[model samples]
Target chain A: MLIETDVLVIGAGPAGSSTAKHAALNGSDVIVIDKKSEIGAPKRCAEGVSKEGLKKLKIEPSNRWVIKELSGVRMIAPDGTSVWLNEEKVKLPEAGYILERKVFDKHMAMDAARAGAKIMVKTLAKGIRREDDHLVTTLETMGEEFEVKAKIVVGADGPESRMGRFLGLKTTLKPKNMESCAQFEMVNVKMEDPDSIEFYFGSVAPGGYAWIFPKGDDIANVGLGILTTETDKSAYDHLLEFVKNNPSTQNAQPVELNVGGDPVGGMLKELVTDNFMLVGDAASQVNPLTGGGIITAMEAGVYAGEVAAAAIKDGDYSAKKLSKYQERCEENIGVKFKRDLKVKDYLQSLSDEELNSIADAFHDIELDTINTAELIKQLIKVSPKALLKLGKLF
Target chain B: MIIMKVNEWCMYCGECAGVCSRSLIEVRENSLKFDKKKCKECTICIQVCPVQALAKEE
Candidate 1:
């Protein structure tokens, strides 16, 4: 099977689907392929997304995929001190929904198909080579081999992007920048606040945090991400220890397991070259502090698609032309990521006592009445050491 | 010669493949493939494995 398309997207996840949809909508023929037989099985995400994130993508919350709506967020320190922020009062759209990613991902792909993009599942991109003005990608599905020739190749293939490497991009993640994560979908848990998501900080997670995103009254996705350089224990071990010690999840039984690596920092300086562009995890678009990439990936996809379509219309697929995608991404989310990375580094440097002191300062405050600057002022009064380290964020 | 080894605890999650400096690892559906000939034994993959399923072998 020799197929030729204006854009070839390798991965059927959020990024690739959105890219294909926008490209096809703009009158470019797009083809998307994934190695998985099913679109979204064996989930790697904790399935948390903000309402603002959805609004930016012009997508409405659907009951078919949305499992729970959160009302607030809680941050717990190592010494058991916690600070809760009301979602409505803070005007932070961070509180959102816990989704059934298996269904959500499939729906996203369906949207691309409706927009006239072709999708091929269980297809693996074996290799890619340049040929004249176009690129040829060898694909293998089942027991047969085929080729796809496209003027533009979009690599949306997760953190472990073979496509990016094949295109001669430096996509390797450093140990300090990558977070090894493990998650379990547990049931029969006793959640005190089912309407809010919880984060546990300090040595329990080591350079990262543990999360509990409630899926229902008695179920949640219990997970943690840890920087490998911080500790000798694997992410799984940290998660198991966290689950055993945490009160609400001490008795919960895990029904599903998820493990993966996330690029928390170190965004690729270059995202495109010639006729190729990288989106999503391949491009390291995840938030440095929260390690969330669904929204960012989709945003990058939209930009990539628009740029690819314009490039094709102009009949110029050079790196210089494709760089418009990079510019749009940097303007939209890259600036925020840079600041978040600094904050993440500062947080990682704090000791358990320092974290406890920070939590203590916020515990008695009226979070809604105070702005971030005021809160930081209050924090500085309580812990002067934090003032120097956190000054960079402002 | 140095090579990367995958133990039984491997989850096929592809964490190692993504961080491999040399891009020498591949995660199939149920197995992991290592291009031993091109491996530099940087050990980045072993460090990033969530389950500690990978190791450096000589």
Candidate 2:
């Protein structure tokens, strides 16, 4: 069966769906395909995102998908010296939230569908055949095989994206640039303040941090991410210890356990190639410092969709044309990502003592004070010993 | 069932000590020290410490 469309988007996650939605909205014939049978099932995310990121995607926060509105943030030093650095706070209307990713993803897909994009779940792209000016894709749909052609293809697949690799772009990520994350949902867990998310740094989660994002007063998602190169222990092992000893959650019942890997590298070498563009994890759009990718993925999707439509209208689908999407992302966030990558590089080299001293220097950063670069500079001012390492990181 | 392991690079910022309700961490000689026995092994010290200095033994 040869299905044809102006734009074909792979993967149905935030990036893919948003890409399809934006493209369809722009009067292009868009078709979205996902290997998963369900559009938003088996959610793999920490599900915490800043308000500014959502605004970039024009996504209004909805109550159905938002778990909680965080009041502030807390940072802990290695020796237990906790300081609230962003103490002078201004109330941000859309501060931040713990989201139900499955619902959030589905909602985005629904938006795409409403905008006239045809979605086929359980349809996996097996291979791509470039025939003349068009690209043909072999797809496996519900145990059946089919073929489809498109003028332009957008890869919104997750980190395991073959489209990016098959095209000869650099997808090889070092262990230091990736995070292995594990999470547990606990019920009846006593939380200190449900309105604020909690993070633990230091040895508990080497190369990464542990987070307690509250769903409610007695329910929270407790998770940890470990840099694979920094520690031999798995993320699950660290999370298990956090549950066993913490009184606030010692007696809690485990509702769910999730584990996954996140690519911390900021961007891909070539997110755009001939007749193709990559978004989300496929393009390495995740934040290096926080491992958050939803907003960036959505932002990329919007750009890709818009670009796909324009490309189809212009009848130019070469790598040079698709590169505009990358240019747009670079313009919007490229500087920030480069700076954040430097921060990640610098952070991975710190010792526990150095980490503690840096913590002492900056204290804890509050919600109102989330200047990542400034905090690192302040730490560098105090911990001159870490300066040598800082020079290499920057 | 929680195993707490302190790593070699700990900076002793005391953020872990402050957040540890169980009082498992202490600062001595400008270094952050963990009392393994007193450490409920909650691993909160590891997460809040910011420097990624603490570890949980599997």
Which candidate comes out best when scored by TM-score? Answer: 1
Instruction: Score every model by TM-score.
Output: 0.97, 0.81
The digit string of per-residue lDDT tens for model 1 on A1-394 reads 8889899999999999999999998989999998898887788988999888999899888999999998888889999898987677764433588899999999999999999999999888878999999999999888699999999999988888888788888888788888899999999888778998999999999989999999987999999999999999999999999999999899999999999988898468889989999999889999998998889999999999999999999999999999999999999989989988877888898899989989998887898788889887998887786578787687
What's candidate 2's DockQ score?
0.02
Clashing pairs in 1: none
**Where in model 1 is the C-alpha error above 4 Å?**
A91-94
TM-score of 1: 0.97
Compared with the true structure, what per-residue lDDT tens digits does model 1 show for residues B10-34?
Answer: 9888888888888887776677889
Candidate chain B TM-scores, in order:
0.90, 0.69
Q: Model 1, chain B: what is the TM-score?
A: 0.90
Can you tell me the CAPRI class of model 1?
A: high
Q: Which 10-residue window in model 2 chain A sums to the lowest lDDT?
A: A85-94
